[model samples]
Target: MAGIVIVGAGECGTRAAFAARDAGYDGAILLIAGEAGLPYDRTKLTKPIVPGEAPFGGLSALRKPICHANQLDAAGITLLAGTPVGKVNSDARQVTLTDGRVFGYDRLLLAVGATARRLACRGGDRALGFRTIDHAQTVFAKARGKVVIAGAGLIGLELAAVLSGQGAEVTLVEAEALPLSRTVPAGLAERLMARHQAEGVRLLCGSEIEKVTPGFVTLSNGKRLPAPSLIAAIGVVPNTTLGAMAGAMIDNGICVDAQMRTSVPGIYAAGDCANVTLPNGQRVRSETWRCAMAQGIVAGQVMAGQTASYDDPNWLWSDQYDLTVQVVGQVADRPDALRQLPEAELQFSIDSDGALIGVAGIGRAAAMTKDIILAQRLIRAGAKVTARALSDPAIDLKSLLRTQGDV
Candidate 1:
């Protein structure tokens, strides 16, 4: 029986395959992969730069299998690697491969992830994109020389950190005045900016690119920078061709309800290609690794005749030169409160009712991670924490959480 079919076997697709089994769906599952080779964790692509290694294993070394043969076999998931889907016929509940292979499904999950947004400036095509493993291979091959990177967002900054650690002369240019303005709080951005500069990263915020040649970049101000290798980590555009062709509603992305069901019945989407629509008509754009996993679980469980919905707070972490930054709850960089610790600094976003909505922390990896997790739990429980209490290092957050009746 053609039980369930999942397109685009990234983390979301692969996880959903297993999640269906965990949800007790005893049926056939087909997972179509766009890229060949085993599905690996995409988050490890630009993290923890390895200094001067032989034959280049920095990326491959971090290839944690999303689903191995043993796991797939045990979970009873059929994985078709390197398959390009030609068309998704929702009316017929079928997915057709470019090679003309047809597979029908009781339910379909489209996790066709996003592609790197390219630069629109003149000669911008010269810059390489950093997305999949193939994209990283090209960038990593030339990272030993002078490199120019556009955009100071998370992707750009992380790439800069990795390349700079490898002794490359790196320049990071962003259109915004500050890096990570949207995801990171202002205070953390300042600290991160300083760290990047100290580590020999030429960060040029509030900058624009005029043109990019094969080996050089010209800024709007006529500053020509040497670029033996150039990369664009600007952002991503949702890959919604198949979903749209299948007649699903598309807004900022393929619109999915709380349970990850698309507007079309028996169809759903998750991961980077999905925008979770709320009851109030707002869409939540969650594109991180954890977010993908969460959405996959929701989609799979709901598809397997179980009830589930994705309403969790979004959280993500970034690693750069021994410093790890994590944010949860209210993502606004401008926080309503601040807490300064020796090992880490916490920025808090509190609601008007005095409930802690968000928190951003940066410092030592160990300290930052612990505090962030605690803050996430508190925020999830809608803890009405005050600035005064959060400000005092003496007042333990765990104690405060206990008062709210959460373990």
Candidate 2:
């Protein structure tokens, strides 16, 4: 009866199951996932899961041999794939599956993940947002020449790079003036725009799709483009309906506290579907793989009667072409507070106190720099983010390290 049940066998649920076993919780751990096959990295879908690509030739999209689910199974976790939870009766301590089976659990973890958000424009239903493996495969199979993608979000830009790099004429339309405006500043967005343009991908900022017809799309500027495929990377909505059905508090995502504990006792939520506020006063439902895994570990540890708190310095990365962009901690909530570093190399998000809240870098730097940023923030210390400090050419890093008190 002390067993833990995890819903949604993505990175979050799988990590919780593995972590539970690794932590010596020798009880029945059940992972219920809607996806039929093994859990693969969803971020890699835009890059490798597209059909007809060299990487998508075989079952390699699932990372054959050393797969996500396989690794979980190796840790003695029971996985129930292709079976989704239909309803949760938290009061009665039971979960009903779509097939009319009920399972009881002492502790439950909600890692249901999220679904891609759809635009409310005309003919929007005809568009597809990449959220699952099947969707990516279907989109890639149907994609041929000239694809019109709406939205300049991470998913849209990543897919544009993949399709365009593979010889498809890609036209990416964004309503915002810059790409990734909500996440990155204008300078980073402009640089990303330049990279996409250099690779022959058409960028349309401050543009909207007026209408969509078969094999063609009409733009707001009275321009009609021909394309057989359309991808809408607008945003994502958390999979919180099940939690709501069970009478759990729901916000943009399932609202949780610093401990990943839901409003209801014995029930917890984590991953992209759970909206959590960090110690630094930043609230975000991060969709990054690392956040999901780390949250899962924390949830699992808590479910197994551990007192540890989930205080992760959130980080995310996107791999497009040869560029690897890494973001650490929460950027300044205010747009104007973000300052760009010299050579357009890095950007710092400073709080009202002028303490660094986050750091985002464009070019490669020492891996330790990223680790230090995360480690310091995880301990709730000053971010130490300064433009002159990072840009000084003559400053020795060793001396700078000596100045800081024990981290």
- Identify the candidate with maximal TM-score: 1
Poorly placed runs, candidate 1 (over 4 Å): 48-61
Model 2: per-residue lDDT, tens digit, 1-407? 43788998777887787777777787889888887867667866776643455333332232322156456667767778898899999888888899998889998899999988886777877887788877877777766577889998888988888878678888999998888888765666778889999999999999988888887788899898886888888888899988797777998899888778888888899999999866656677888888898998888888877765777767777767766566677664333233233333555566666565566656444433544354345325664445565455344434444455565
lDDT of each: 0.86, 0.75
Candidate 1 residue 331 C-alpha distance from true site, Å: 3.1
Tens digits of per-residue lDDT, candidate 1, 255-305, equal 988889888989999999999986657688777888899898888898899
Q: Highest lDDT: which candidate?
A: 1
Displacement of the residue 366 alpha carbon in candidate 1, Å: 0.6
lDDT of 2 at 86: 95
Task: Give the Cα-based TM-score of candidate 1 against the true structure.
Answer: 0.95
TM-score of each: 0.95, 0.88
Clash pairs, model 1 backbone = 185-333, 330-358
